[model samples]
Target: MAPNMADDVNRAVSGARPRLIVGISGASGVAYGVRTLDALNDLGVESHLVVSRAAAMTLSQETTLSLAELNDKASVVHKIGDVGASVSSGSFRTLGMVVAPCSVRTMSEIATGVTSTLLTRAADVTLKERRRLVLMVRETPLHLGHLRTLTALAEMGAVIAPPLPALYAKPASIEAMIDQSVGRMLDLFGLDWAPVRRWQGMAADAPE
Candidate 1:
């Protein structure tokens, strides 16, 4: 192949790399977000991470890793307040957005279209652009209001995927369990990760 043609092909392939927006809100199980970034890196997907202020505090409280280290895991880290960032625009193509360990406050804000931060703004852009918006909502013991908000989000095409462990996968450790859930979330974007143990099937006549 000609040198110029080879160079053009390389540029095309580089430009076609898949991108996804990852949001980490102030919720427990921040490991989910951390592992999501790790998985994306493994899959060669460009991850645009936006960490909320409350999530920053949660990260400090829950993990020994510094915020700088967390940011380094992502391909691009956008400021929480940078609403004008590329991710906040619909024209910026991406696979979609995932709010790992999504806080109820963040979910509610996205559902209402009242995005107060770049994280939520990117989510709103995802929804408006008809792109997949997956929410790994962490709150449990949902009341009527929380349920209603989640329903509204679902109705508007947001995926409500809580990070539930696939006990069937029989995760040997907490990290394995977290990887299983993060793998499932990535599946929604059609990016398969190695940690996801695929369910084959039970023996037809072995058990009830």
Candidate 2:
């Protein structure tokens, strides 16, 4: 049976646990997606995760955790090829979707609406539903085409949040930097994470 849209809507309004779809593409920063799941877990949000094949390769190279261990972090794990998953429908009624470490290929697929995987397909669904779709784009040294693609996606209501470190937070290590960026991404969904060092203001000093 198809999921009851009404029930999902009611649950959303009745303070039920919020749901967010997490997509991990074949970007360099797999740690961003991993920490996103961790933050969601800490916030009590139900996470629906879909990781790309290339991401599996990147994960193997970048981190010690196996794919199974990474899947264990999510509330629900959707296979990359499972286009028929619950998150693939707008009626699932989620807070929205976040594509952490969003790769150029995945972002382009989403912009073109020619999604080849469940990861991009779910992102497409998020956009069509007018929900907040935040893409933490991970590429650097972008050329003109990349700029244009990002512009198009921005026009389509997707937030292009590059996971740059918040130097203002005075992060002590690389992990702190990652957490800060992850926290800010969660902020888009109005989810407050403890590790986010919100700016208070310039401290009064004699710099003048």
Candidate 3:
């Protein structure tokens, strides 16, 4: 690398604000990832987003919003094939990463460290740095292999949080349920979101 280019890279990284890398894979619930970016924006956290091609297909099928509409929610958007992207390196620095609605395929790729795409490569970087990496795995009817893979990831220091709605929140609508789930995930990064249905105590909500 050239001297000037090195200086530019250093300046860019040194000036980086608190940020989180958001990954969306081809999973059933794209909204979890979408709202995750929105919540990060709400909490004044910069979001770097990368979406798999399969995820783009899933988003079109599940929501009326276009791809640009979803991309607009993020502070920075990187091409999935761009392995040279800033988030691909641990030197870039971030709060960590959260792959909302993480697909089984993506999870398996990250677990084995056989990263073929920028999405998984960035996840590999996060894990290597010992940074918090949360995977909102959205699959169901898990077999033994899936369970074992999840265990391996947990041992590797990745948090596996399935978006199971907290029934105790007594959610009135699906959107509320989604928010509650997303908010709780943000809690892992030490971010507080108002929509979280926090458990106060046995009589948690007995009017102040």
Number of the top-ranking candidate, with TM-score as the measure: 2
Best prediction by lDDT = 2
lDDT of 1 by residue, 115-194 (tens): 89999999998888777889999987999999999999998888999999899899899999999999998888778899
lDDT of 2 by residue, 1-208 (tens): 2223444335454656889899999999999999999999999999999999999999999999999999999999999999999988887878789998899999999999999999999999988887788999998899999999999999998999999989989999999999999999998887899999999988698375
Q: Candidate 1 vs. truth: CA RMSD?
A: 6.7
> lDDT of all the models against the reference?
0.89, 0.91, 0.89
Residue-level lDDT for 62 in candidate 1: 88
lDDT of 3 by residue, 1-208 (tens): 1113233224434665578899999989999999998898898888999999999999999889899999999999999999999999988877789999899999999999999999999999988877778999999899999999999999998999999989999999999999999999998877899888887778756787
Candidate 3 lands at a TM-score of 0.90
User: Judged by lDDT against the true structure, how good is candidate 1?
Assistant: 0.89
For each candidate in turn, give its C-alpha RMSD to the true structure in angstroms: 6.7, 4.3, 6.3
The candidate 2 region of ten consecutive residues with least summed lDDT is: 1-10
Off by over 4 Å in 3: 1-16, 204-208
